[model samples]
Target chain A: MSKHLKHLLTYVVALLLFVFMGYPFLYMISTSFKSLESFFIEPFAILSWPLNFSNYTEVFTMGLGRYFMNSIIISVTAVTLVVLVAALASYPISRLKFKMNRPLFLLFIAGMMLPIHATLIPIFVLTQNLGIYDSLLALLGPYIAFALPISIFILTQFMQEVPKELEEAAMIDGCGHIRIFWNIMVPMTIPAISTIVIYNFIHIWTEFIFALVLISSPGNMTLPLGLQRFYDEFSVNVPALMAALTLASMPILLVYIFAQEKVVKGLAGGAVKG
Target chain B: MQTVSPVKTSKHLEIKKKKKKWKHTFTICMFIAPALFIYGLYVLYPILSTFQLSLSSWDGNPAGPTFIGLDNYIRLLSDPIFFKALRNNILVVLTSVFIQIPLGLILALLLFAPLKGLRVFSTVYFMPFLMSTVAIGLLWIFIFDPINGPLNKFIQTLGMKPVAWLGSPDTAMFSVLLVIVWQFAPFYMILFKAAMVGIPDELYESASIDGATGVKKFIYITLPLLIPTMVTSSILAIVGSLKQFDLFYIMTGGGPSNATELMGTYMYKNAFLSFNMGYASTIAFTMFLIAFIVTVIIQVLEYYRRKKGVFS
Candidate 1:
């Protein structure tokens, strides 16, 4: 084939792929800007004139803000805890020579394939017994627990690559394991740490089933649960629901837009390493 | 006198070595304790609890469980819905591995083509994956809306009747399967893209010198190199398919006469909606077992394949 023909073919295929992957999102954002009458009249139109901004303002009033805040608080807290604990555990697992090192690493790695459903009922019961059900606190345990396997996996993989000499030199300076981990290992593993943070943050931010099971109150619900509630309460008012979705998805989108390379790498890093 | 001095020094060094080893073990324990405790409580213990619960009947009440000794499993063998759900779960696994992975590879290859506006094309292609499953489910619900959705409107434009995409049993699974492909194909795209970048440019250069065409080079070189990634992607898709809940739960709730019932959705309904926690545990444990068995089988196969030097 001629080079020009090949180029044209590439563009054609790219456009079709774009529509398949992206058109739904476009329709969503477009519909969010349509009034009910306009939506009913020209629901399939890519864009409607006399754009409606009411849906955007209305979703916030319907407690999207509360869900947003709850999600941020929970995700930040859980990601922080996961990073710290996973990193601490990764140091010994990756660097130290314990009898259980290989077995322990495999044990944690096995959690990646384990279904959350298996543990769902017991977790629900445990949360209730702890008197923390229906609140943000109920989510923390599972979020951190679920995030650990991958976090430890990624951190240990990266830690294994860090030169042993750096930590050994620190030890020679009379620095204890804690001191070396804090000063040497943590600094060296910042790239991996950031990947874990982004990966877990996205997972926790949009985590659904756990929130659906544990959290009941609107005020305590995360973004995914809150979005589900919006769907239930306002099934007829799709414009408003789309607006809520657009808002709920904004933070991740914006993060991706700004840090495209890092976001892609971070999201793919865990699976790619395997 | 010399022998006695040497023995004393050696004995002292042995005692010191034992003390150092004890301290090293203590430090390792301290580091591992927090993660192990949380992982054990929430993950390890819950898995055992699910297995134990699967043996009995319970209503998720304070009255406690009654040990029925695998009655739930016995009932599961006869339940039509459970069988339907298991079959649907397998459908999801097949769709993910067969359709989604190939589609993802196509998109990833498109991104590497020498085309203008590459950034725009790549960005839009990845947009579906960045949205939360809840958001994606809700968005697609509107898109598949029987009356006002663009899909039916487009169908009407084609001079055909508007179909109830999600409302009909025949189409619900297909509709959701399309959405799953859309949501996850980008993930595999990035995975393939990362792997593709690791393929050395020198190999392609050598192929060019050998008078190799694009397709030939891809077949002989690129495809062979991507086998590891393909294996990893298949494993992820299969395990992921078994555990998928949010999309199906939000989209159809496994309805339209159970046409789209997956094990995850079925288990959710049993536990929360119907309050049959024990049967739910039974389904949930079975999902774990399937995933575990599949993972182990894949690992063993991959190990033996590597041992036999199949790919390398």
Candidate 2:
């Protein structure tokens, strides 16, 4: 084929693939807006009528609002602990060379590689023994552990790139280690910190396995669990389920839209390093 | 100018100053202590305890477990569903590494290409991955509804009849696989795109000048350069797919004959539903071992690959 033909062919194929890639999500958003009577038909009917938001209303009314709240609380806590702890932890590993530094860095990186499926049962049992099995604590603790390695890894990567002269100059002024870290390292890592925060947010937000295994208490369901529960109760209510699904996903969706460039750049390296 | 003290007291102050020279240790310890303690308490200990628990029978309702060496593993080997789950887990991993990578790369390439509207396109393509499993499960359930779903709707558009997808054993595994790929392709795409950015534009420009075309450029340049990342992402994808439970739980519930049950889902049923903590712990160990082995293999392979290459 001619180069023009090849380029055209590639572009055409891409457009088609893009549509196919997005169809289910498009179907989801549309179905989220579809009236119950028109749920299945609207896909073919081409929506000559006005879009409805009653499903959204029903979803909110039907306990998703509470699930939303629970998810926000758990995710916020998990992200907070992950960012704060990883920030503190990455300082020594990144700036201060010590014995077994390389090995210790590898250890945390290995944690990034370790799949938590292996650790699921023990978490469940541990939570039960601690008697907080159904509370947010169960969810909060593991998320911090699971998220630590990556947050630390990324922060260290960013920290290693900062100019050492700044810290050296500070040290010359009689600053203590904590002051140097808090005043210099922390501020210097804001971009990386925000990036880490967003990554942790998305991960904790979408994380399902630990939540699935540990959160047995219906009252403490996260968004993932809440959506699962919504599905169980409203399996046939396609519009409402679609609405709940859309709502469950929209926060991160918008977050991705606004921060996508930063997200993509940060993730490209971070993800494959896993 | 300092406070007047005896020579012996001055020596003690000097010792404290020497100790303070290792101050990074304090910051390091303080930084790592909180995360390490929590992780060690919650994550690391449980892994060892689960292994210990697997060696014995206990409903976990009691204060202690009865030691029964290797009995749970023996029983697990004898069970057919155990075999089924193992096969299914392997199938999920294999399909994900072999099929999903290529698919995700294709999508990533499209997003990277001069294709119009790249931003909107990539974002939409990445949406399913962003969607919670709960929502994706429900969406696929509709697609697999056998009557009113888009999968069926499009099938009939081609003048073919819609068949029950999730309703049959043979089709059920593939059904879940479709959802798996849909949900995770963006992860690889995002990773590959990052790698693509690192590639010097001149290499592609040089290739084009040599009369190299699209696929040729991708093959000679993109593929070779991305091998490390590809390998890394594949390891992640394989490990992740091995333990997938949310979709398996919400969609088929490991059903139509338990055909779609991965080890993670099976462990949940055993440990939580049936309260067979011992057998469940056994299953958990097997998964841990598999994940550990696979991860180590990737790291070693990457290590060797790095050694042979000039790059780190």
Candidate 3:
């Protein structure tokens, strides 16, 4: 009898948690399917028939596509650069026995705690001096630099666990360091590489402060900035704003749905050891 | 196979070895240069520049800055809003450590319960963590809307008056902190879940054989074993709390009379809104110092804890 009571109690708690966490998402998506008049009249409805699609059309027409494209360009470019550069740096730090290896690795790992606000003013000033203050190109430098620490840390940890015999054998066969790095270390660290790619891609995709400070042009605004501006411009249009948010959030949600385990592991990679 | 003289061959081998060492050193430097250059130019240099700017009085003009050594810091000592923001930031740290961490452990435990539809429960629980902070903030604003929001609607159903959750000073900080907890608890859930997975099954089995109940096993086995992860989660919470900006900026902009202002939003207001770059740099530098000091303290405490555990 007590076992049955415990089972019932578990379901009750689970149900309450599910409601707390999931209702807002359900409401947002549901409200996006309602017209303005319907939303005002029946704000608590669960998206019944005669569903409205105009909110999606209206939000898309209002320059959300530009923000999406900008986010894609910046996130992809920055992730690619960070992966390649971090891998090259991690190769020597993890594999070689040079005197500066440990200190260099520590320098990069220490960056994980450095707040971006500390760098914002100087980076803003530097971008202005470089004449790329409002351009999409302005974000690449900070994005790649800030991403290096965690990427290099993850890559080096994974690389240290890689077996050394094959690389030593390759070295004996007169293969150069570049060749061994490309052929051996890069191939071996694919899991860590993927972790960093997913990790950095998500962060850069939603990055706000740097873009908010450096990029002022409407055309160059990333998704987060564009979304905030859109809300400010049309604060009363709740349905349209929900539509915009739903669209803005689709990519990451889809990625999580399809690759749930990978996303979870990638996100927790910073705080937990695999 | 060589017929050459031994002395000449040995001398020739030494020259070759020297050349190889030089090549190796060059390769190492080449591999590290790009990452170092970018990190230095963007992160390291900016930190020093922020410190330098904090010592000056610059309104971000075309003309050079006026160096008023330590004036910004001196003024910051008496700034009321700065202290309020600091107090709010500490509140977030306390909320994250006490509320979010325990709530996360509960949610993670729920996922492990012998119940139905756990997959569905976990998926929804983690949904908030996956969305952008801006999106989450916007969604919650409507949910807290006084006239048309669901929370007020539910209150009306209870025959109570509607409250302006984000508009009033009394509830503004609590409302935003609630949303923050909702958004972040799942993250700690995953962290705890990962750590729980690492606990050996043999321990649980042995506990069961010794006639231990579920609560007893949890207290003796699970809680003590989660100490390291708890420390890590606390550090993440504290550091993350200090750097928080986006959600508060979107939800309240530190408004309703500065009730929700954080150092991040305060710094942004000074730098971008007012162009008080010098003062903003002071706030930013102070943020960096607080985070650095807190991290060092936690690590030292952890080191001693581990040492005591080893001896005992």
Clash number for candidate 3: 0
Best-fitting candidate, scored by TM-score: 1
lDDT measured at residue B211 in model 1 versus the true structure, 0 to 100: 95
Q: For candidate 1, lDDT tens digit of each residue in A1-274? A: 9978887988898888988888888898998999988888888887899999999999999999999999999999999999999999999999999899999999999999999999999999999999999999999999999999999999999999999899889888999999989998999999999998989988998899999999999999999999999989998998899899999999999999999988998888778662
Local error of candidate 2 at B58, Å?
Answer: 1.4
Candidate 2 stretches with Cα past 4 Å from truth are A40-50, A272-274, B1-14, B21-27, B310-312
Model 2 per-residue lDDT tens digits across residues B1-312: 366667878899889987876675676788778877887877788888889888989887767788899999899889899889989988988888988888888887887777767778888777777777767887889877887788888889899988889999989999998888888888788877778888999999999999998889988998888887777778788777766778888889889888888787788888878988888889988888888888878778778878888333
Ranking by lDDT: 1, 3, 2
List the candidates' TM-scores in order: 0.98, 0.93, 0.97
TM-score of chain A of 1: 0.97
Q: Interface Cα RMSD per model, in Å? A: 0.7, 2.0, 0.8
In the order shown, the candidates' Cα RMSDs to the true structure are 1.4, 3.1, 2.0
lDDT tens digits by residue: candidate 1, B1-312: 667789889889999999999999999999999999999999999999999999989998899988999899999999999999999999999999999999999989988888788899889888888999999999999889899888888889999999899999999999999999999999999998888899999999999999998889889888999988898899889889989889999999999999999999999999999999999999999999989999999999989989999875
Residue pairs of candidate 2 with colliding backbone atoms: none
For all the predictions, what are the DockQ values? 0.89, 0.62, 0.81
Per residue, candidate 3 scores C-alpha lDDT tens digits across A1-274 of 4988888988998898899999999989999999999999999988756999999999988999999999999999999999999999999999987899999999898888888899999999999999999999999999999999999999999999989898899989999889999999999989899899989998898888899988998899999999999999998899999999999999999999999999999999898753
